[model samples]
Target: MKHYFIAHKLFLLFLAKFFLTYILLTVVYQLYLGGFQQNQIDGITQLVSQNTQQLMRVLDMDVLVLKDKGASVMVFYKQKYIARIIEGCNAISIIILFVSFIVAFSGKIKPTLLFICMGSLVIYGLNVVRIALLVVLLDAYPEQTAVWHGTIFPLFIYGVVFLLWVLWVTKILDYAKKTV
Candidate 1:
């Protein structure tokens, strides 16, 4: 095992390859999830509907509308977009799945399974941060919310993901020459 970690320099190379693959897979997955994401939206809507008052208490936002926006329920809180919960499966979940899939692909069988489980958890945390930032933007700059949620946040999150992959490949995978 020690020899496998040290002498097998090719393993480091393979790890870098796997890390890059994971990133591409994750981004592709995110793009897919960027689509409607109906089911997740629906589940979240249902939960909110059931605990509407509790949600109001939690967010301190007054709900003014809960009408059918064609296919989805457009819930307006304080004249801002609290949420738009859709009704079926959407592309966003695919992002989570893809990130996990690609990381898993790096190691088949046992290794894949472990990486998928870990990667999923990490991605979920990142997703929550993404949502939180969107919510903040929605509250702070209602007019420019679209710019933040749709563009800025994606770039920031992807940059973070890319940096993470770079760190994993160069530092964790022992591919970089140590300076210190």
Candidate 2:
């Protein structure tokens, strides 16, 4: 047992770091949600909605308007509601997971912090685009909203995160080799 533990020490350490970070972040997030004022929008979801609105406007989809709907945001196109943006659609949890994974395979402190910040921004930006595109797609193809929302968009976001993780691991491995 001791030999096996020694051989897998690094892997065990990574797992411990990942879980601890994930759990801590998740608890903080839950506390944040709990502290929200009644009828107020969560900050992250509001940012996502605003970004999506801006993107739609830039893309010449000015017909759409974003309205705060208590805990969610609603996208209306020419006075007709198109889609509702909920908390789950905001991508905070996904960002948390991404950050946790990167921190687990962390290299130097500065690089790790920078990577987490940049990666989180990238994920947040992608999520805004995803939501905006989803709204447009759903409006155009209402019949396929289920397929698009449930599978395609999720797969795209997760795929990007997976690629980022792969890149982080490659860099960590390279750094380890150099240091050794």
Candidate 3:
């Protein structure tokens, strides 16, 4: 029992450091990405609108906007979810927070009040590409639109966000530390 307690204490410390590092990374990354994403989103909106008009001449549907706020694509397609993508970045933050608290309560970390803010700019980029491809596919293969919407596009877009999260945790954040 004594040995178990000691081991748990040590493990808790490592978890704490991991969590602290994660919080710092998330905050800085969020601020950095928020601005960059806005600009990219604006550009994507323009591109999608121009292209959608040229390609899909549907009687009722229209590409009203193209922008990713955090991790969502709000496409007012004839007042429906014509084209949209939800991001997990916000959810990631919550997940991290919960993990951090769990480890902390185990007598490990002191969760930062600065708050963990997962960055989703890369996810935003993926969404732009996702929407663009969906638009193209809708035009070229109208018959297959439903399939693309339900399966292919979600996989592609969410896959990108998942990949970005993996990279951020393993690569970008690590490289950032090495450089520092």
Pick the TM-score winner: 2
lDDT of 2 at 27: 99
lDDT of 2 by residue, 21-64 (tens): 99999999989988887777788788788888889888878545
Candidate 1, residue 65: Cα displacement in angstroms equals 11
* Residue lDDT tens for model 3, 1-180: 988878798566767766785787578647655765432533334544444443444434455554555444555544444555343322345344433543332321232222222334444444545565676576667789779988997677656555644554446445345547
Superior candidate under TM-score, 1 versus 2: 2
| TM-scores of all candidate predictions against the true structure | 0.48, 0.91, 0.37
Residue 142 lDDT, candidate 2, scale 0-100: 94
Cα RMSD, each candidate: 8.2, 2.2, 11.0
- Per TM-score, what order, best first? 2, 1, 3
Indicate the worst ten consecutive residues by lDDT in candidate 1.
Answer: 85-94
lDDT of 1 by residue, 1-180 (tens): 888878976657666765676677767755654674443444433443434434454676565435464545555656776655443312235345345434532434564455446555565456544554455567767789679767887776666556655654455444355433
- Residue 70 of candidate 3: its Cα lDDT? 44
Which regions of candidate 1 are displaced past 4 Å? 1-81, 85-112, 175-180
What is candidate 3's CA lDDT for residue 15? 73
Off by over 4 Å in 3: 1-119, 175-180
Evaluated at residue 48, the lDDT of candidate 2 is 82
Q: What is the C-alpha lDDT of each candidate?
A: 0.53, 0.85, 0.51
Ranking by lDDT: 2, 1, 3
